[model samples]
Target: MFGKRNGLFFDGKITLEQGDPEFIELFSRFAYDEVVNEPGAQHPDLDDATRSMAILATLIGCQGVDAYEMMLPVALETGVTPVQVKEVVYQA
Candidate 1:
């Protein structure tokens, strides 16, 4: 389920509002409802920390450095350690 501020369970630093605000909703639906919420996408074995690390790796692989920077705080808050981040980045 999406949060109240945006249609996302997690905070995404991507600034889509500068161009088309509606895309935010569209993207949220696509990412959350269509992707993240997909039955096969569900991984009960993946804990929050593991998930966060994977996301960080994926961001780095995708060249989303800005988003990666912004997401660092949230990642730590969610119990992802600095060392884990570094290792994930290195792997990416």
Candidate 2:
């Protein structure tokens, strides 16, 4: 499911070679299935857009600039407005 959910943010298909299938399998399960798909009631039924915003805020707070950049498009695709993204960045 790497390419499946990754396509939500990225443009083209994601291709992983045959090295370290374990890493691939675990990352696919967590990033795609768990975080994107099956987010439980951890935040009082937060919607995808809200979750994406929160993720952006957390990334900023953690100084995860690279990860934040990677996730910015995904957050925008989830309907997080540019103003909201800016607010999160400022608040961080």
Candidate 3:
């Protein structure tokens, strides 16, 4: 989280806990801790770039353009290249 925090988060919370505290809490607990950090959900063989690409594809398929735009920079920072992102979009 800290490594990807520069643009995606502010002071340990996304958008400085904007809107409602509950939203931040739920997202942090469920998305960050419970799901993303779950031991069983992680793959030692899959690098960050691969994971980010897959996530971008998922977001595109889900029609999460707003979220995709928000996360694109972070994905790049985490090692996902622009070409990979484009291919994911192309594939979708």
Candidate 4:
């Protein structure tokens, strides 16, 4: 399904040596294609930066270090400022 290397998040940089290929494939499809590609609502009230900050706060509260690591880049990419990210972590 990953026709292009750029379409895959980690792409050729990381290897999923420990997990079952079937499970990985399924999760990748669901997470990237289904969840990320779908925007069920048009929440003009919450912009991308705000959503990123909320996600950061939730990640901090949940102690989701790995997920935070992964999402931090996305947050920054979506225009979340470094100061705001730091503030969210500090507040959490």
Candidate 5:
């Protein structure tokens, strides 16, 4: 419940509401250490800002409103500016 409200992007209670279940599950497994944690399926070694950029690109490509909104905190955490996010979208 708090995960839904603690962030500004997603309106629903679960990642399924914001993005595909497969995407969420894949990202979760890759983002953490305890899950599937496949070496070949791992996320790229990017800084937080770059990671945000990649996420923004994926969201924009998918037209994922919930995912896009939810990524704001990660973008901020990664020092990815709003302008950067927009730029990535425009470039994509």
Candidate 6:
């Protein structure tokens, strides 16, 4: 799902790395809980594609590559298109 880290500072995974330190810190605090405990914390009304699009939109906005990778299978399962997902993150 991700590539190798090129340098010692990073893991070279599919990641998002453009945000304030505070946001990054807070996101780190609960990101695990959200991924582990509340995988469906986002919109539950929409189908997978829409839901995945929402996730993609958010992760890209927050620069959260790990979460994005973790959700990839779900996105695909929910029928999200590569085009749609790419569109969501293209301008990020």
The superposed Cα distance between candidate 5 and the true structure at residue 21, in angstroms, equals 13
41-65: candidate 1 lDDT, tens digit per residue: 7688987787888888888889998
Ranking by TM-score: 3, 1, 4, 2, 5, 6
| Candidate 2 ranges with C-alpha deviation above 4 Å | 1-17, 37-45
Candidate 4: minimum summed lDDT over ten consecutive residues — where? 1-10
Q: What ranges in model 4 sit over 4 Å off? A: 1-19, 39-42
Q: List the residue pairs that clash in candidate 2.
A: none
Which segments of candidate 1 are over 4 A away from where they belong? 1-19
Compared with the true structure, all predictions reach lDDT values of 0.79, 0.80, 0.81, 0.80, 0.72, 0.71
Cα lDDT tens digits, model 3, 1-92, are 34436445534654545547787898789987888777857788988788889889999989999999998998999998788888988999
Model 2 lDDT vs. the true structure?
Answer: 0.80
Error of 4 at 39 (Å): 4.9
TM-score of each: 0.68, 0.62, 0.69, 0.63, 0.53, 0.49
**lDDT of residue 19 for candidate 5:** 52
The best candidate in terms of lDDT = 3
Q: 1 or 4: which has the higher TM-score?
A: 1
Tens-digit per-residue lDDT, 10-79, candidate 5: 5554446355767877767667754435554446665668867878888888999898889877787879
Clashing pairs in model 6, backbone N/Cα/C closer than 3 A:
16-63
- Provide C-alpha RMSD values for all models, in order: 8.2, 7.4, 7.6, 6.8, 7.4, 8.0
lDDT preference between candidates 1 and 4, better one: 4
